[model samples]
Target chain A: MTHGISMAGYMFVNPGEEILVPSLFWGNYNLSFINAYDAKIKPYNLFKGEGLDVAAMGAELMSEGDKKILLLNFPNNPTGYSPDVREMKEIISAVEQAAKAGKKIVVICDDAYFGLVFEEGIEAQSPFAWLANLHENVLAVKVDGPTKEDYVWGFRVGFMTYGIKGGTEALYTALENKTAGAIRGSISNTSNLSQSLLLEAFDSPTYQEEKKEKFNILKSRYEAVKQAMKNPDYAEFFKAKPYNSGYFMCIELKDGLDADVVRRLLIEKYSIGTISLNNLLRIAFSAVAVKDILALFDGIYSACKELTV
Target chain B: MTHGISMAGYMFVNPGEEILVPSLFWGNYNLSFINAYDAKIKPYNLFKGEGLDVAAMGAELMSEGDKKILLLNFPNNPTGYSPDVREMKEIISAVEQAAKAGKKIVVICDDAYFGLVFEEGIEAQSPFAWLANLHENVLAVKVDGPTKEDYVWGFRVGFMTYGIKGGTEALYTALENKTAGAIRGSISNTSNLSQSLLLEAFDSPTYQEEKKEKFNILKSRYEAVKQAMKNPDYAEFFKAKPYNSGYFMCIELKDGLDADVVRRLLIEKYSIGTISLNNLLRIAFSAVAVKDILALFDGIYSACKELTV
Candidate 1:
């Protein structure tokens, strides 16, 4: 599943070719693409004024060299921000614009934590649903897995689906063969037990009910975090990114304060661990219980107050 | 496990460098090393007069330009031959000799079948036990796992242990970090289920006894195949390679007869199947029952004669 994003970088993108990921991305993309394949990464601005920066992305897409690769992870990893239906449309249009400009775009949609939405009116579906089998110059590759969405974290089961148009049967077959061969060239095979367990679970009578129950539990935790953040006490510490989906949400440190000091102080003094990146602290709400959400935030707030002093 | 060989190629061996593998090798080594990494494969003849060609290997090790990687798999994949103690010593000496000649040789001992020795005189210990930390220039990397020896084929669990010399604590730590980083860059992680299952199995009451029982079953099958191959009725068809270990044994087609013809005829007419490679038919004794071994070979002999006519 991790290899889906990795294959796009290692197998599809040529060395030294620039892959335009967003400014805010899952850090492993760099390790997968740049460190693995020696490809360069160019970031498109993710957000402006608490909304997706579609215009900046469009400009970047049109301006970056043709025959480029774009990594689009919605309900994104760190920020947990999912684009609304209109935003999703605009994002696709940007890629289509590039394709219309005769630019070949291989869009890798990494839906790691798909369908974990906590808000209304924000469409939470795979870009695959629309982008696949849609265009000529745009090859939509959706990378997903049962690992997260299925709540089988230890299974490591993932999938890659290609929605490429403007190619004949032979061409498609060749492309699929290449994808399989790329997988073979990397990991020999996915573990069989995982695949079997997943298949059996899918066949089980309670699959949907179980999934919904799990989703509801996570939804409660997500809501708890949101309710706690509105307390006005954390406002002095950091402002969060516009987030309502996936496992995590990020808080941008206030007054340009660095997250490193705050992160270290929280771990050292308060024993509250969060992912520190740039000027933000990424809190994963998935594991935090509904009741513990506030206390977790309180510790972070205490750490910030101490660090600021 | 597959990437263990590849890591030696992609990480340890520089681009355009040469890797020395036996003429008879698990073919994926070529795919992983030469094709994937742009490294050249230098094959040393596996046999000289029905025994390991130590003289030829030593000569090649001496002549090949200083920086090289040697991939040693035993009990070998196709031939199932585990080198006797003397042969093992000769193999190590060749590397030590190269190191003494101011050459840096990274020996990747792919000990996939580490303990499955069929012959009495063959002490099939990993080369790491002897070669690791012994030389200044020779680095021994042993790759093995519970996948084969522990009777877990579907589980792709593997381990890679490095033994390098001329390194201080910091240097070694940095080297280990780089190796881990390489693994992280490739596959994000091996399946957590596999790791957990293996850990549980190790902690089980009868891990060693279970492994021993599995080993004994393979040993019986291996012996049966060996005894069956001794039938002079098959001599006209092919000459068996000196095999004493592992799952498979290969027979060289007499008079350079094409193995493809025999393989196809055996499948179509005799309803028997075998892996046809180069001029040899590789029979996997691991899966073939003790009583079925004779019939399997008889069918092959009948096919060979009919095809030859």
Candidate 2:
């Protein structure tokens, strides 16, 4: 875990440079910056709809030149809202422009919840695979591990790589040597056993069949929660938006209703716990049983009603 | 693994500091310095008869202040030799004196082969348990894993901690937080399955009995190898010193005989393979059968005799 983040930090920033991260990002990123690399991190706010404000992010990058690296997590955490493809393209374009202006732009695509984008025909394309080969100055890094994807959190197996690039063999060699040097220096080597198990799992004849079934189950649970939120009692408590994929969704509360207070009330008063993300209450739909989703929402609805009065 | 090393690196050295290591030490120590901490490594020579040259090491550290971090490996790999207590004390005292002189000394005791010291009664004590309490500026770190000790290599379980003066709550808190941060950042958490197996192995009622039996088997094998080296026919080709414990013994070749050439000749001509360290060949008595000890030496004896003229 430390290796993965530190590796990510080394890939994104140069010595004494600053990188931009979303304010609502995973907390480990902060630790990686301070503990792994002595670099600066600038936080950008997520827009009202819980997506990257492309215009604002572009402006920040434009102001900073190539000294800025942007880290994006979508099917975003704490709030499972993924931006539209148009928004993603805009973000990539802004990064490309920054790269063209003699600045090194590293884009870290953390596709943890990648395949679970909920909306039909709204598949999330990895910016890494797209941008890697296109621009020389633009370096794309993809950090994905089997922990969440394979539902094997204990495996502790992850992979990092230079997204598709049109680099010479020498360039690739240097990158691989440095990465291997990093791996060699850290824990010596990843567990050969873990790597073997992951390889076996991936190569299993039933892998695709198993993966599809699991994905459908989580997808159904997410849909159930989205539908349950439509009940009038809960409707006033949440601002509904298009939620296509992933295990979680965000509900923005009415003004004067603190998400933290509501979260505590839900836990203490209703024995239900949800994560508070600023003004939004993020519920993990995959964690609870599908049959219990309606009941869970009922508790949230009651808590909101009690708080409203 | 990477996180473990990175944290280990931090535990020993400060940012931009230099660490001294033996060329034969684990490759990851170099990785930890270059990849993880951006620190430099000064490689020192391992003496022929003695393991590490204490006087030369002292000369190196005397020039560099107490800010020097040294990684010491015993029953060393590629060449398994644990220094005598007198030599170890000399090294420790030098570091201690440097610390008292206002140098910050961090001694990382890579006790991977802690219990495997071959010499009877001359086994090195863990500098870890002593250094923590020795001086305010001195820190002794012990890095050990159940891999070698418990014969559970696939478990990938190990521990890192300050052995000496970390008795205070604040010290404990800082150590815990730093280690946790490293663990959280790297592999997230080690395999819970691996830890469970190790815990169970340690708690097994017959654990000590099993270990003792294995130790005796290795001891018998070591004695056989030592006895075989006493043959008049082999005496001129090899020189054997007192090796009371551990899995391996060193064989010093006669003058003008290269260890690497002799090793290849033994392998190709006699189908025996051994690790060569300069003019010395390391023979693993633990894994080799007692019955084969004479045959192994005869092979070496014949190879050296054939090549001598």
> Which candidate has the top score in lDDT?
1
At residue A270, give the lDDT of candidate 2: 90
TM-score of 2: 0.84
The CAPRI class of candidate 1 is medium
Shift in Å, residue A157, candidate 1: 1.4
Local lDDT at B79 for model 1: 88
DockQ of every candidate structure: 0.61, 0.50
**Mind giving the per-residue lDDT tens digits that candidate 2 earns over A1-309?**
445667778655666667777666666776677656677878776674544578777777778444668787777776676777877787778877777777667777787777777675453776676678757887777777777778766776677878545788888788888777666666666665777888998999999899888888888898888788777766577674445566677777888888899999999989898988778787888788889999988887788878989
DockQ-derived CAPRI band for the predicted complex in model 2: medium
Please, what is the whole-model Cα lDDT of each candidate in the order they appear? 0.83, 0.73
Instruction: Evaluate residue B276 in candidate 2 and report its C-alpha lDDT on the 0 to 100 scale.
Output: 84
Q: In model 2, state the lDDT of residue A118.
A: 67
Per-residue CA lDDT of model 2 for B1-309, tens digit only, reads 334446778655666788877656555566677666778888666574544577777766677554778777776654566767776687778777777788767777777666765456464576675566887777777777766666665667678877444467887788788777766765567776677767887899999998777767776787787688678777788886435555567788999888899999988879898888778787877789889988998888888888898
Give every prediction's interface RMSD: 1.6, 2.6
Instruction: Please report, as a residue range, the 10-residue window in candidate 1 chain B with the lowest summed lDDT.
Output: B2-11
